[model samples]
Target: MAAMATWFLIVIYLAFISLGLPDSLLGAAWPVMRPDLGAPLEAAGMLAMIVAGGTIVSSLASGRLIDKLGTGPITLISCLMTAAALLGFSFAPSLLWFALLAIPLGLGAGAVDAALNHYVATHYEAHHMSWLHCFWGVGATGGPLLISYFIKEHDSWRAGYTAVAIIQVALVTILLATLPLWKKVAAQRSMLRASSRPHHSDASVKGSNKFTAKTDREEDIRPSAQPMRLPGVKMSMLAFLFYCGVETLVGLWGASFLVGARGIPAETAAWWISLYYGGITIGRLITGFITLKVSNRILILVGPLISALGAVLLLLPLPGAITLAGFVLIGFGFAPVYPGLIHETPVRFGRANSAKLIGYQMAVAYTGTTFLPPLFGLLASQAGIGLFPVVSLLLIVLMLLCSEYVNRAIKRKYLIA
Candidate 1:
C-alpha cells in the first residue's frame, strides 16, 4: 500500500511537470513568435489570456467529471488532449490557428490541475501533497529553460512540443499500468482491517433507524445547499486575484523588464527570465519541506513582504545584477502563495466542498491573469516601463493585507491545524 501510494504521487508529479511545459515554451518563445506572427502587443498578451480563459471555463466542468470518473481516467484524457493540442499548436499555419489550439490546451491543462490537486489531497498525506506541488514547480522551471535552449540552438520550437508530446504519452501508459495495483493494495488493506474487527453492519442498521428523525432535523439545521461560505473566501479571492496578477506580470513581463527597462539584449533578457522561474522552482521545493513545521499563516504573511522588498529593489536605479537579485527574491516570495491557498481550501471548507471552492478560485484567478498584465502593458506603452514594478508593488501590498485577514478567518474556522 505504501509503495503504491509513493508511486502514485511520483506519477502525479510527472503529469504536472509535463502539463506545465507548453506554457513555458510559449512564454520563452513569445519574443520570437510575435515578430514571426506579426502580432501586436495586445495580441501577444491575448495569447496568454486566451489559454487562461479556456482553462478557467474547463475547470468548472472538470470538477464534476473528476467526481464521477475518478482521477486515473480523467488524467489520461487530459494528457492525451494536451498532447494533441500541443501538436496542433506546433503545426499551426497562422496566429488564428495558434489561438484556436490554445483553447483545447487550456482545457486539458485546467482539468489536470484541479483533478490532480483533488486526488493528492483525498488520497495522500498532507506533507506528500506539498511535495507533489514541488514537482510542479520543477516542471514550471524546466519549460522555459528547455525552450530557450532550443531557440538558441536554432532548432524548431516544434521539436520542443514533439518532445513533450512523447513524455505525456509515456506518462499515460505508466499511470494506466499502475492504477490496478493501487486499487488492489487498497482492497487488501480494507480486508486486513476487516479481519481484525467485529463487523458492525447490523449495529449500524439499528443505529440508523434510531437516528432517522435526528438525521432529518440535522439536515434541516445544516447550512443551505449553497456552498458554505468561508470568511477568507472573499479575501482569498482578492489575494489570488493579485496572485494571478503578480505571476503573469512576472512571467509575461520579466524578459520585457530586462530588455525594455534595463537595456539588456533580447536573448540575454530571455535567459534572465529563466532566473525568475528558477527561484520559483527552488522556493517551492523549500516551502514544501518547511511548511509542515512552520506556521502557514506566518509563511503567508512573510511571503508578500519578501516580494514587496524585491519590487522595491527593482524600482530603484540599481545595477543589472542587483535587479536580477530582486527578481529572484520576487520569484521565491511568490512561489508558495498560490499552492498554499489551494492547500488551505480543503482545510478551511472540508474535503466535500474543496472542488467547488477550487473551481471558483481558479476561475477568478485566471480572469485576473487574463486582464491584469495587459493593463500593465498599456501602462508601459503609454507611460514607461518604470510603471511595471510600481504597479506590481501596489498589488503586493493588497495581497499582504488580504493574507492577514485570511489568517484570522482560518483561526476562526479552526478546521485546519
Candidate 2:
C-alpha cells in the first residue's frame, strides 16, 4: 500500500509538470507570434483574459463535476481537452482562432488544477504539496525555453505549441493507464470513512452502527452535508485573488517591461524572464525543504514580506542588473505562497468542506488572473511600462494585508491543527 501511494504521488507530480507546460508558452511565444498573426502587442492581454474567463467558469463548476464524476475521470478528460486546444494553437490562422482555442484550454486547466490541488491537500504531506508545485515551476520554466528554441530554429511559434501538444497527448495516455490507481485511493478512503463512522462520539443510540449500507451510499453520493459557508473563506479568496493577480501580471508582462522600460535586448529580456521563473522553480525546491522544519503559517507570512522587499527593489532607481535581481527576488518570494496557502486548506477547513472551498478559491484566483494583467497592459500602454513596478508593489501590499487579516480571522474563530 505504501508503494502504491508513492507511485500515485509520482504520477501526480508528472501531471503537475504537464500542467505547467502550456502556461508560460503563450507569454514567451507571443512577442514573435503577435506580429506574425497581425496582432497588436497589447492584444495578448485579451488572449489572457479569455483564457482566464474559461478557467473561472470551469473552476466554479468543478466541485459539482468532481463530486459527480470523481478526480480520475475529470483529470483524464481535462488533459485530453487541453491537448486538443494546444493542437488548435498549432494550426490557428489568426489571433481570433487563438482566442477561440483558449476556452477549452482554460476549462481543461482549471478542472485539473482544482482536482489535483484538493486531492493533494487532503491526502499528502505539506512537503509533498510544496514539491508538487516545485515540479510545476520546473515545467513553467521549461516552456519558455522550448518556445524560444523552436522560434530560433524554425522561426515558427507553432512548432513550440505542437511539441507541447504531443507531450500532453503522451501524458493523457499515462493517465488512462493509471485510472485504476485513482479508484483504489477512492475505495480506500471510503472504507476508512466507514470504519470510523460508528465511533462518532455524538451518536444518540448506544452501540449503533453508523456504517450502514444506506449511510455508505449517501456519503458516496454526497460527501459534505453543508456548504463551506464560513466567514474567513471570503478573506482567503481575496488573498488568493491578489496573489494570482500579482503572479500573472509579472509572468505575462515581465519581459515586455524589461524590453520597453529598461531597453534590454529582446533575447536578453526573454532570458531574464525565464530566469524569473527559474527563481520560482528553485525557490520552491528550497521551500519544500523548509517545510520540514518551519510552520506553514510563519512561511506564508514571510513569503509576502520577502515579495515586498523585491517590489521595492524593482522601484529603486538602479542599474539593469539590480532590476533583474529584483525580478528574481520577487519570483523566489512568490514560491511558497500559492502552494503554502493550498496546503493549509484542509487544516483551516475540515476535509469534508475543503473541495468546495478550494473550488471557490480557484475561481476567484482565475478571475484575478483574467483581468489584472490586461489592466496592467492598458496602463503600460499609456503611462509607460514603468507603471509595472508601481502596480506590482500595490498588489503585493494588498496580498500581504489580506494574508494578515486571514491569519487573524482563522486564529480567532477556529482551532486549526
Candidate 3:
C-alpha cells in the first residue's frame, strides 16, 4: 500500500508537469506562428481570451464533473482533450483554427488544474503539495525553451506543438495504466467514509452524493443558490482572485518592464525573467521543508509581506541588480501562498463542502488570470511599463488584505484556529 501511494504521488507529479507543458507555448510560439498565419500580433490576445473563457467555464463545472466522474476519468479525459487540441494546433492553417482549438485546450487545462489541486489538497501533506506545484513550474519553464528550440532548429512553430502533443499523449497512456490505482484509492476513501458514519443509512450516502453533486451548481454557479451565503467561500474566492492577479501580472509583464522601463536589453531581461520563475521553483522547494516548522497561516502572511518588500524594491530607483533581486524575491514570496491556501480549504470549510469551494476558487483564480493582467497592459500602455512595480504593489496589498479577511472569517465561522 505504501509503495502504491508513492507511485500515485509520482504519477500525479508527472501529470502536473504535463499540465504545464502547453501553458506558455502560445506566448513563446506566437512570434513565429503569427507571421506564418498572417494574423496581427494583437490577435494572440483574442486567442488567449478564448482559452481563458473556456477554462473558466470548465473550472466552474469541475465540482460536479469530478464528483460524478471521479478524478481518474477527469484527469484522463482532460489530458486527451488537451492532446487533441495540441494536435489541432500542430496542423492549424489559419487563425480561425487556432481560435477554435483554444477552447478545448483551456477546458482541459482548467479541469486538470482544479481536480489535481483538490486531490492533493485532500490526500497529501503540504510539502507534497508544494513539491507538486514546483513540478508544474518545471513544465511551465520547459515549455517555452522547448518551443523556442523547435522554432530555431526547424524554422517551424508547428514542431513545438507536435512535440508537446507527443509528450501529452505519452502521459495519457500512463494515466490509462494507472486507472486501478485511482480506483483503489477511491474505494479506500469510500470505505473510510462508510465507517466514519456507521449510524447513517444508505439513504444518507445517496443524499450526500446528490448534495455534493449540486453544491457547486445550485450554491455557486446557478443564479438562485446563494453561494456567498456559505461561510468562508466568498473570501476564499476573492483571495484566490487577487493572488492570481498578482502572480500573472508579474509574470506576463516583468520582462517588458525591465526592458522598456529600466533600459535593460531584451535578452538580459528575458534571462532575468527566467530567474524569476526559478525563484518560484526554488522557493517552493524550501517551503516544503519549512512546512515542518510553521503553520500554513504563517507562511501565507510571511510570503506576501516578503513579496511586498520585493514590490517596494522594484518601485525604487535602483540598479539593475537590485531590480533583478526584486523579481526573484517576489517569486520566492509568492511560492507558498497558493498551496497553503489550498491545503487549508478542507479545514476552513468542512471536507463535505471543500470540493465546491475549491472549484469556485479555481474559477475565480482563472478569471483573474484572464482579465486583470490585460487591465494592467492597458495601464502600461497609458502610464508606461514602469507601472509594473506600482501595479504589482497594489495587487500584493489587495492579496494580503484578502488573505486577512479569509483567515479571520475561517477562524470566526469555522473555528479552524
Q: Write the per-residue lDDT of candidate 2 for residues 3-117, one digit (tens) a residue.
A: 7777888888888888888788777776677778998767888888988888888777877898999888999999999899999999999989999999999999888888887
Model 1 Cα displacement at 99 (Å)? 0.6
RMSD of each: 7.1, 7.0, 7.1
> Can you tell me which runs of candidate 2 are displaced by over 4 Å?
188-231, 346-355, 410-417
Better of 1 and 2 by lDDT: 2
lDDT top scorer = 2
For model 2, what is the error of residue 318's alpha carbon versus the real structure, in angstroms, after optimal superposition? 3.4
Clash-forming residue pairs, model 1: none
Between prediction 2 and prediction 3, which has the larger lDDT?
2
Candidate 1 per-residue lDDT over residues 268-332, each given as its tens digit = 66666677777777877887766656645556777788888988999999898988888888888
Better of 1 and 2 by TM-score: 2
lDDT of each: 0.71, 0.78, 0.75
TM-scores, all candidates, are 0.84, 0.85, 0.80
Clashes of each: 0, 0, 0
